[model samples]
Target: MSKGLKGKLVLAISSRALFDLSESHQVYLTQGIEAYRQYQIEHEDEVLEPGEAFPLVKKLLSFNASLGRDRVEVVLVSRNSADTGLRVFNSIQHYELAISRAAFSGGRNPHPYLNAFGCDLFLSTHADDVRSALDAGFAAATILAGGTRRAQSNELRIAFDGDAVLFSDEAERVYQAGGIEAFQVLERESARSPLRGGPFKGFLEALNLLQREFPDDACPIRTALVTARSAPAHERVIRTLRDWDIRLDESLFLGGLDKSAFLEAFAADVFFDDQAGHCERARQVVATGHVPHGISNPLRDLPAD
Candidate 1:
């Protein structure tokens, strides 16, 4: 296992992702949310689940083992109920699901807590939690647009931007903070320099480990980098990946072009970037994640709500 995950495949999933009532399951696990929240407040540690969500958790655990990934680690981040955690654990055992770790949180927000757990990725119903995970240096996704189960084929197609996903956002920060002129100056001076680390570097390492475990000789895990930076800016991105010993199947430096069309062509299961505009467009074409700007990136003006 890579040092990123600390030798564990830590996945932080919301309570809802574990169970789907639309499917057939007698014991509904969704009811215990409020109870679970209360329990957590009273007792320090507890795991809760709604009646509708347990079967799905079992399925996820089975899938994790089948994929050779570590057993699923679930954290109930919802504040709805305290009893939810206990109910969830009981259902997991009742259904004989294999789980590596299970924990519950108090009224505290789930995303920051997830960071403390060293979670590699977070799955949740709340969009804020997803965004928070990305900001906190973790790969995160919400089940809004679609489900990961849909990508159950032998190959999984994943896409990301070059600047802030694979490489550090320092250059982008310069551009945002000091405008195009300052950015140009920095890029020109740093032309021969290597790219720095970004949010998804750890994720790339994890994928490499997975590749070693499950080699896809014919149909490998398809990966791509779609970015707006062209030519001169692109060289640093490529060199950085090479230096880090990272492998990418496809990379497109679009030179300020919209990435939606290319992402559609790639048929990506998931695409990630720090810009909401790109995410807004790509979400229509594929599963998309909006990686929050790192603290170093200048805060752009927020549109009025």
Candidate 2:
């Protein structure tokens, strides 16, 4: 018989995203892979400090305690070969994380395996991997390392941006090519039509399913739509979510106000946005991931120089 990942709420994470492997990553950058492998082997027993995505991962796994083990699974999927990954396993053991499965993809990009693993989300610090994962049609984000580490709260709070994130970049492309007024006008006109879902739609649907596991308002997870859209423009967002049959606990229309303060007030465990600028500020207040999608990711137009 063969094992499969078909029905579980899967999170395929990179080793670096699960633990603090910065020192070893530096060695790989400056010294080389051999030196990095040797270093990880030597430090096999050292408990790693939590990385940016640690709290979120831990909390996601916590859902299993109530939802049953079959409901959630976290796979340690990364480019690290088995030889250099012992330290990561050791750290997982030391911290007592519930993750057990792994796929050591060596030098190859692991994004392809997201579907193989039925991954609802794929998070890594590697921008290339993230981009590849998104391109491959998985809900993916680049974990921003060295952010203010968020302590695991009793309730899981996830925040997401509107354009290029929860909703498609259709209106955002208009905003980027035209201007704020143009964007607002188009959004207002399309208010009744309901914007299309973005890349995280499946991930959010998975989360919504998890929220349903609990009866009534007792679900431990709460979500927020913290976006820059304001006024009549906000109508499309609301209609879009309704059209998708998705419900968010809170929606903050900042109209381009800095989102850090609002996210802080919401106490988000993790925040996702397509822009590096929003993630920079969000990470300062909470754990943040850069969803490198839509028109914002310029590498699509201009090759890496």
Q: Which RMSD values do the candidates have, in order? A: 6.8, 2.6
Quick one: best TM-score, which candidate? 2
Q: By how many angstroms RMSD does model 2 differ from the true structure?
A: 2.6
Q: Estimate candidate 2's alpha-carbon lDDT, on a 0 to 1 scale.
A: 0.85
What is the TM-score of candidate 2? 0.95
Local error of candidate 2 at residue 176 (angstroms): 1.4
Off by over 4 Å in 1: 1-6, 16-82, 85-100, 112-117, 125-137, 141-152, 177-185, 216-220, 295-305
Model 1 TM-score, all chains together: 0.69
Q: Against the hidden reference, what TM-scores do the models get?
A: 0.69, 0.95
lDDT of each: 0.61, 0.85
Model 2 spans with C-alpha error above 4 angstroms: 1-4, 300-305
Q: Tell me the deviation in Å of residue 227 in model 1.
A: 1.2
| Candidate 1 residue-wise lDDT, 64-88, digit = tens | 5566666335555543334445555
